[model samples]
Target: MLKKLFLVAAAAALFSGCANVMPTGGGSASDAADVAAAAERLRIAMVDPTRPALSTLVADELSYGHSGGKVDTKESFIADLLDGKSDFVTITITEQTVKVVDARTAIVRHALAADTNDSGKPGKVALKILGVWQKQGGDWKLLARQAVRAS
Candidate 1:
């Protein structure tokens, strides 16, 4: 009888441990919100001139297109931005939509208006931009960005 009781107690303990190990759905909403916030923070960091470190928000392997052409790396892209290579660097996001693709991935679609300091003025150049973000060590980083002129 003593051995049977011990076996039952051990089985209960094993089952309880398994239950604790199972994934719970309760924190998903909070997790999604956190991901979205991280993405937004990256966007804000990119535009702040004082904080050049925010440039790291972009991944080493980023892709982007502008009035001049397409760029396939963070270094080249930043070089162009700082060099005033782009005709206009004005980017105003009118609308933004964010979707969480996974625990560490998100996609943001932004309706933007852009104009170079020289050629076209504000409101003349408009585009839609699709940005992909990935969360790494609690901070969100931009993995890719592509822009298409709005019709």
Candidate 2:
């Protein structure tokens, strides 16, 4: 039947997407571990913001999206941290997972709980974060990140 064929095709597409997230050929476990460590370093840098550290961790084409729908480019992201507009007093990442797509790319997901003092006003946030990282030369740099409110 036509309906049955459509359903089968859709299911196949869905499973193929999942296969990418699940670990495939050519990437090793150590690659995942390295990505995790890179993510941890970025978290620490956000808490104690410094331009050098942030610039090093993020790619030139970084796209950072906040839970509130605002997006920041790499320069704006680092500038906000340096200027106290986006300040992280403390950040805790939990239930983190990293999926290495290849020797040069990875995807990371985690639950984030953070205390903030942005523009000198204190606040707290709970978010689900997805980060895409790419290996540049010898380091993994964050290429993009998106955050959504955790329900």
Candidate 3:
């Protein structure tokens, strides 16, 4: 009788584990749309100097390299913008590509172009930016961003 009881308990535990493994119906088409929208909003915010709220979407510790140089942190990133390090920061996302790599992860590809306006006029600069966004606490936040010069 004890052996039978043990077997029953094991079966119950196994079934319970299987129940938890059932799909939660996450990562649907709507989720993909929402991710794309969020990414575009972030791009808009980054370019619009008046919108401070958009900046929050960016990770506080972002690393970026510009004009064929080394990567830098968020603080330096902001400083660069304010100090006229990047002449014209025009983020043109030719295509907002959202890929749901997992239930809670997405990758957004943004086609971008920038001009260094430190000389008081826009200079020629073009690049493609890829941003990785992670869903955190019901909101999507940018976790990482990288730029590759568009030849």
Model 2: lowest-lDDT 10 consecutive positions: 12-21
Question: Which candidate number has the best TM-score?
Answer: 2
Clashing pairs in 2: none
Q: Candidate 2 on 47-92: residue-level lDDT in tens?
A: 8778887998999999999989999999999999999999999987
- Which candidate comes out best when scored by lDDT? 2
The best-first sequence of candidates by TM-score reads 2, 3, 1
Q: In candidate 3, what are the lDDT values of residues 69-119, reduced to their tens digit?
A: 768676666565556664346655564466777677777675676544653
> Considering lDDT, which of the candidate structures 2 and 3 is the better prediction for this target?
2
Query: Cα miss at 44, model 2 (Å)?
Result: 0.4
Q: Model 3: residues >4 Å from true position, as ranges?
A: 1-26, 87-89, 119-121
Alpha-carbon TM-score of each model against the true structure: 0.63, 0.83, 0.67
